[model samples]
Target: MEKEIYSLRSQFEIGLVTDTLVMLLDRGARVPLIADMPQVIPMLRGLLEGGLRHRHVYCRDTDGVYTEVVVFKERYDLELIESASQIRHFNRVLAKDSTL
Candidate 1:
């Protein structure tokens, strides 16, 4: 199971929005594994709530530099989080309009 889980890790990415919010992004074409991985949710939450002593995920910052980010996964309702693609599309449209 460890090998399977590790393999699936590449299909998704996680981002920290705030101390109490997190964003999960699907990088693969397959259906998101979020629904299938129920056990991961509580583990993520525990790590977040447990404070800085826990391990962190390395992520790329806005400057394209990799940094260790502490994820706080407080919200479990997937419907409340917005997808990265939608945010990108909105930014593109906003930038286009601004140039006019």
Candidate 2:
């Protein structure tokens, strides 16, 4: 995570991505895994509600899955993230737009 992002998360009730999740942008993941993150993050958010804790998110890859534990801020935006299906569709549109 960037220092600025960490600061923002600390000061504001907003969302920020973890370093482990950040790597997913460069290295693609399995479709099911991609689809599952939104659901998982929310479940994790629910667990950490009103508490300071860390949750481990397992990244699924063709080789296998790797674990990345993230400390979600207490006020992380649970409603900001969209569902995996929505993400998939949005990404498809971006891909198409880039090709045009």
- On TM-score, the leading prediction is 1
The local lDDT score (0 to 100) that residue 39 gets in candidate 1 is 48
lDDT of 1 by residue, 13-85 (tens): 4543345434344445354445424544555556566543344333332332332234355433333214666
Which 10-residue window of candidate 2 scores lowest in summed lDDT?
A: 5-14
Q: List the residue pairs that clash in candidate 1.
A: none
Query: Please, what is the whole-model Cα lDDT of each candidate in the order they appear?
Result: 0.41, 0.35
Candidate number with greatest lDDT: 1
Off by over 4 Å in 2: 1-30, 47-52, 67-71, 74-100
Residue-wise lDDT of candidate 2 within 19-99, one digit each (tens)? Answer: 322212213332433444544455545644532343333332333333233535432322223366645643564346446
| TM-score of candidate 2 against the unseen true structure | 0.26
The Cα error of candidate 1 at residue 43, in Å, is 2.8
Cα lDDT for residue 92, candidate 2:
60
